[model samples]
Target chain A: MSTAVWNGAGRRIHIQEVGPRDGLQMEKAFVPTAQKIAMVNALSAAGLAKVEVTAFVSPTAIPALADAESVLRGIERRPGTVMTCLVPNVKGAQRAMGAGADELNLVMSVSETHNLCNLRMLRSQSFAGLQEVIAVAQQGQAAVNVSLSCSFGCPMEGDVPEQVVLDWSQRFIALGVQGITLCDTTGMAHPAQVHALVRAFKARWPQTPLTLHFHDTRAMALANVLAAIDAGADRFDASVGGLGGCPYAPGASGNACTEELVHALQLMGYDTGVDLAALTQVAAGLPAQIGHDIPSAIVKAGPVHQLHPAPASLEEIRSRAHERLQATANGL
Target chain B: MSTAVWNGAGRRIHIQEVGPRDGLQMEKAFVPTAQKIAMVNALSAAGLAKVEVTAFVSPTAIPALADAESVLRGIERRPGTVMTCLVPNVKGAQRAMGAGADELNLVMSVSETHNLCNLRMLRSQSFAGLQEVIAVAQQGQAAVNVSLSCSFGCPMEGDVPEQVVLDWSQRFIALGVQGITLCDTTGMAHPAQVHALVRAFKARWPQTPLTLHFHDTRAMALANVLAAIDAGADRFDASVGGLGGCPYAPGASGNACTEELVHALQLMGYDTGVDLAALTQVAAGLPAQIGHDIPSAIVKAGPVHQLHPAPASLEEIRSRAHERLQATANGL
Candidate 1:
C-alpha cells in the first residue's frame, strides 16, 4: 500500500496565541506583570505569529490585568510578530493603542443574554460600543479584529441561527474590521452546522479573513476546525494548554489546546510553523506553575510512535516486545 | 437559538473500550491478573457496552496477558456487555473460546512491512491465519471481529492506498466477520483520508459494523473520529486515561483518551452511555499506577465551566468576579 502524502494547499494555519492574556487571566495566582511579559516573550520565541499580550479593560473590572500597560511594554517584540490586546470599548481601545498593541480585538456577544451578563450591556449597546472601539483603532492605525462571541451556539440562547452570525459578520466587515472570528462560546456547534456556517459566510463575504475560535466543551472544536478549513477558512484562535472558558457557561472546556491543534495541522502536512517539541516543553511547565495539570494529550503522552527505553532485563524486554506485537496485532 | 438536543439516531456514538487488553499489555508493570479483572469490571460499571479484555496469545509471546484465563475468570460480567479478547491465530481463538470470551478480535496488518515486522509473517500468511481463526470461532458460535492494522498509513511503508483497506474489508467481511476496525497504526491519517476511507467502506458494506481506532501521535484522532462519524461510523476504540501505544510505531501517543472521547461524544449530543464524572474518578488513579500523567484533557481541566468555589469575603468575591469578567471580555 503506497502512502498518500497530504498535499492539501499549503496555506499556513495562523495560530493566535492567547496564553498570557486568555490563559493567565483565569488563574487564581496573581501572575506578576513581569511573568506575563516573560510568558508572552517566550511564546514569541516559540514562533507564534500572533500573541494576545493583554486586555485593556478597567482595573476594577479585571484585577489580573490591572498592569496591562506595563505588561505590554515589557514584552520583547520579535519582528513580524503581531501583539494583540482585547478591548471592550473606545477607552480600552485607546489604552491598548497607547500601550503599543499591534492589533486590537473587539468582541461583541451575539446573544442578548450573554451580552447583558458578559459586557453589562444590551446587544444593541454592545454593537454601539464596537462602533466606537473600531473608530478609535482605525484612527490609531492599528488593525482591528472582531470576535463574534456565541456565534455557533450560546448557552443562554442555544443554537444561534446562521443568519444572525452572517448578519453580524457583514456589519463588522462593513465597519472595516480586518478579520471576523466566529466563536463557539458555549460549544454548541456540530460539524454540519460548522461546515454550513463557514461555507455560507465565505460565499457571502469571500474576501473577509475568517478566524474560528472553538471551545472543546463538546469535543467538537477540532472537528469544527476541520469542517471550516474544508470550507476555506484557515486562521484559528487557540489557547495554549486549553486554558480559558466562559465563567457563565457550564461544562465548557478551554479553547482547543494549541499543541493539539498544531499537532493535528502538521500531521495533515499543513505547515503552521510550530515546533511541537518546543510547545510541549512550554506546556510541561504550565501544570506545575498553575497548580493543576494542563488538559493537553500530546504534552503528557508525547508524540506518536515515541519509543521508551527498553528494559535492561531479558524478561522485561521480552514482555515489552510481546505487548508491542499484540498492539500491532490488535490494529491499535 | 434553540437548545441543541441530541436527536437519538444519528447522535448515538459507540465507544469500544480497549483499556483492559490494549492498555495493560503496553505498560511496563505486570498488572496483576486480579487488577486487570477489577479494571475491566470497573470499566463495565462505568457503562461501557464493549470492553476488550485480554489476548489469547502464547505466554511466551505476551507474558503480560499470559494470565488471560485468570483475568477472564475474575471479571464480574454484566448483562449486555460484549467482552472481547484479541486472538492471533487459530490456537488463540480456541483458547479465547474456551475461556468464554464473548467476542474474538482477529487482526491482520494491511501493510506488508508491519505484518512481517510485528507478526513475523507475510500479509497473506496473516490472512490465512485469520481465516483459520474465523473458521474456529464460527464453529464455536462465537463472534469474530477483524481489525486491519495500518489501514490508513504505515510507519515503515508510509502511504496505505484506499483500495488496500477496501479490499481487506471486503475479504474480512466475506469471511463472516461481524465487525471491521480500521487502525491508524502510526497516527498518519488526515481527516480527508479518514472521511474517504470510511465513506468508501460504508458504501461497499453498509451493514457491517465499522469501528475506528486512532492514536493521538499526530493529534488527528478526534478530528478523524469526527470525519468518520460524519461519514457514518458509529463505533470507536478508546483507552482509559489515554493508555497504550504501538511500540512499533515510533512517536505515537496512546489510544484516544476515554475521558476525552466521552466528553466529546456527550457534548456532540451523541450518548456513549459512559458517566464522565465517574470516568474521571477512574482516570485520576491511572497516573499513579502508571507513573506518568495520562494524556487526557478533561482529567486536567475538569469539565468546561467547572467553577472554582468563590472566596467568602466580599472583597475577594468582587476581585474574582472582576478577573472572570475581564477574561470573558478578552475572549480568553
Candidate 2:
C-alpha cells in the first residue's frame, strides 16, 4: 500500500446512492410512489454519480418496491446522475429500460447456495438467464452493471472463494457489462479480505469500472471501504439512513451509510461530489416516512464539522477560575 | 504510508476497555456495585490488555459510578490484566490506589473552553492540579496515564491545534508518566487528522506508549483507528458494546466498540491478544444488566467465523432448481 491508499486527497471517489431501491426493498411498509420519486429526485440533485432508483422485479416478490415503474419514470434525473434499477430477468430488464432507467443492474449471488436460496435458480441458470437479459438490455442501449452478492463471504456457506467472485466478474466483463459491484451482503467482508480481492480484481481488469457494496452488519463496512480504496477502488454503494439489512442475518445493519461515507471522504479531501448537507437532510426525513429508526450515525450526530455552542455555564466557570487564580497569586 | 500501515500481518494491537468507566458514566440507572464488579471481572478475564475499571471522582458528580471504590476492590484481579481508574485530583488518586487500582488515569481537555466547562478550571490549573495528583499517585507506586480530552477537536471550540496536543503530551511525558491517551472526546477526529497526529506523536516519543481513543459519533472511529495504525499507533481505547455518549452532543455514540475493534484487527491478522468470543459474550449480557440496548454489532450479528446454518428452504430450492434444469436440458 502507498500513501495514496490512506490519503484520498483530491481523488474522485464515486458514490452511488442505493437507498431508493435496496433500502426500501426490506421495508414492510410500502413507501408511496410519490415519496419514492421525491427521495430519488433529492438524491440525484445531491451530486451523486449514480442512484439505484428502483428494482424492476415482480411486484409480488418485493411488494415494498412495487412502484418500480412509477418511481423510475417519475423521478427527475440530473445530467451527471445515472438513474439505475435492478433488473432480475429479461422481462425486468425490458421494463426497466422502458421506464427510462439509464443502467440495468442485474444481480446474482456468487455463492451457489445463496444463488439457489435467493434467486430460486442454480448458478448456471442465473448466468445463462442474465446473459439473455444483458442482450435485451444492451439492445435498448442501457448500460449494464452486474452485482455479485456474497462476493466477500456468504453467511450460510462461509467463504465464497475469491476465484468465484473474479470468475463472475470476468464473465460479466467479457460480456461487455459496463460495471460490476462486489457486494458484502452480510457484512462478512473484513479489510484484509477486501484489499486482497479488490487488488486481484483490479490486477485482472484494471479498466473495468468496479463498485463496492457493503453492509455494516458487523460494523466493518467503512473499514472495508477504506481497504478497497487502498486497493484502487473508487466507487461505492451506500444507502440513505443506512437502510436495508440481510434477511439471512436479522438485526444487522444494511448498506454503508451514504451521508456518513460522503462526510468521511470529504473530510479526507476526496472529491466525492456529494452535497453532504442536502443528503443528510434527506436522510433525516427517513425515519418519519419509514416509521422506524435508522442505523445512521450522521443523521443522529451531525457531520464532524458541525460545531456545537460552548456550555452556557462556561462564563461562570471561567470567572471562578480567574478569581481563584487571582486569590492564589495575591496570597489570600 | 507503507503496506505495513494497511497490513497488520503480525503486529500486536493493544485494546484497553473503557466501558465500565466511560460507558456507565452517562447511564442514568445506577448499576449495582455487585453487578459492576462482575462486569469488570468478566472483562478482566476476557484477556484485555487493560480495563479502565471505574472513575474515582466525586460520587456526587457521577452518582452512577458512586460505588467505584467498592466495585474496584471487589472485582477479581487477573494476573495479566492491568486495572486502571480515572482519578481527577489528588484525593481521587489516593482513593484509586487504596482501592488497588493498578494505574491512575488523569484527564484534562486540550481545549481551554472545554477544560473550563468540563473541569470548571483553566487548562493550566487542571494541568498543575493533575501534576500534584501524579506526584501523589507516584508515592503509591501506581502507573500513571494522562488522558487529554478533545485532542482531535472540541465540539464547542472546534479545532484544537495539533501543536497544542503535542505540547501537552510532551509536558506529561517529561513528568515520567507511563502513557498518554489522545482522546477524541466528540468523535470529530478524521482519518487524515488521526494519521498526522499519531505520526507526529510517535515520531517525537516513539518509546512513550500512546493510546488513541475515538468515538463513533460520526461513524468514523474504526476508520480513524485504521489511520492511527497506519501512523504507528498500536494501543486503542474502546468501550464494550460501543458504550458512552457525549453529553454535549445528544444522540451521539460514545466510544469505539471493543469487540468490533478486536474483531476487525484479528481479521486483518493483527495479534490483539483478546478473547473475542469471551468479550462478545460479556457484551451480549450487557443489555439485561443496563436495562438498555448497546450499540455492539458483533453481539447482534455474531463474528464472521460464526457460521449460520443454510436457510431451511435451501434444500427445496436446490431440488426445484434441479427439476428446472432437467426440464430445460430435455427441452421440455
Evaluate all candidate structures by whole-model CA lDDT and list the values in order: 0.77, 0.90
TM-score of 1: 0.73
The candidate maximizing DockQ is 2
C-alpha lDDT (0 to 100) for residue B242 of candidate 1: 77
Error of 1 at B127 (Å): 6.5
Q: How accurate is candidate 1 locally (lDDT)?
A: 0.77
Candidate 1, B-chain TM? 0.90
Return the lDDT, model 2, position B237: 96
| Model 2 alpha-carbon drift over 4 Å, by segment | none
* Residues A10-114, model 2: lDDT tens digits: 999999999989999989888899999899999989999999999988899999998888888888968989999999999998888888989999999999988
lDDT of 1 by residue, A1-332 (tens): 11122234466788878877877788776777776777788778878879989899888877888999999988898985789999988888888989899999888888766665666566666787689888878888999999899897666456678898888888889888898889887666666677678889988888988888888765667777776776778788888877776564433457778888887777667878777777767777787777776667666555543433422453454455567667778999
Residue A173 alpha-carbon offset, candidate 1, angstroms: 3.8
Tens-digit per-residue lDDT, B1-332, candidate 2: 12565567789998999999999998988889988988898898889999999999888999999998899889998888899999999889888989899999999999999999889899999989999998888888899999999999999889989999999999999999999999999899999889889989988998999999999888888889999988889899999999898876676677999999999899889999899999998889889878888888898889999988887888888998999999999999
